[model samples]
Target: MALDRRWPLALFRGAVPVALGLLLWVAVTGGEQERQQTLKGRRAADLTHERRHNELLMAALREAAETEDNVAHRPVPWRK
Candidate 1:
């Protein structure tokens, strides 16, 4: 008799796994939606100071590289 009635028990046992999987899926998607909303509310690099800062950094790097090249390939003052 027990062997013949196993199908119902198998179905009942499966219910918890299905519910947990759905719950995890909903939680992950809900968190992602909240994160997207937060990101949309604030724009990076939208302020004036940020652009000027980046421009200054690029100019400094360019000047440094030019100086290095000029000094590196110049004849050693006493070698030639």
Candidate 2:
């Protein structure tokens, strides 16, 4: 009878700490997921901005090349 009464008390003592540890683990992991999501969003925005800048530079270079070609094809005033 004494052994049976002691077993329930022992079980309750062990269960309390285990339950508290699980709660703490859940809170930490939940915060980490939010941080990961925020970082991913920032990286995606940076990539989109870089792509836009690259396209603008390419268009400018093409316009410059066309201008150069037009100048090259014209005859010199001295030749005429």
For all candidates in order, the CA lDDT equals 0.73, 0.81
The per-prediction CA RMSD against the true structure, in angstroms, equals 8.4, 10.1
- For lDDT, the strongest prediction is 2
TM-score, cand. 2 vs. native: 0.45
What TM-score does model 1 achieve against the real structure? Answer: 0.50
Q: How far is candidate 1 from the true structure (C-alpha RMSD, Å)?
A: 8.4
Tell me the spans in candidate 1 whose CA falls farther than 4 Å from its real position.
1-3, 41-50, 61-80
lDDT of 1 at 40: 67
Cα lDDT of model 1 by residue, 49-78, tens digit? 678899977875677677645544556672
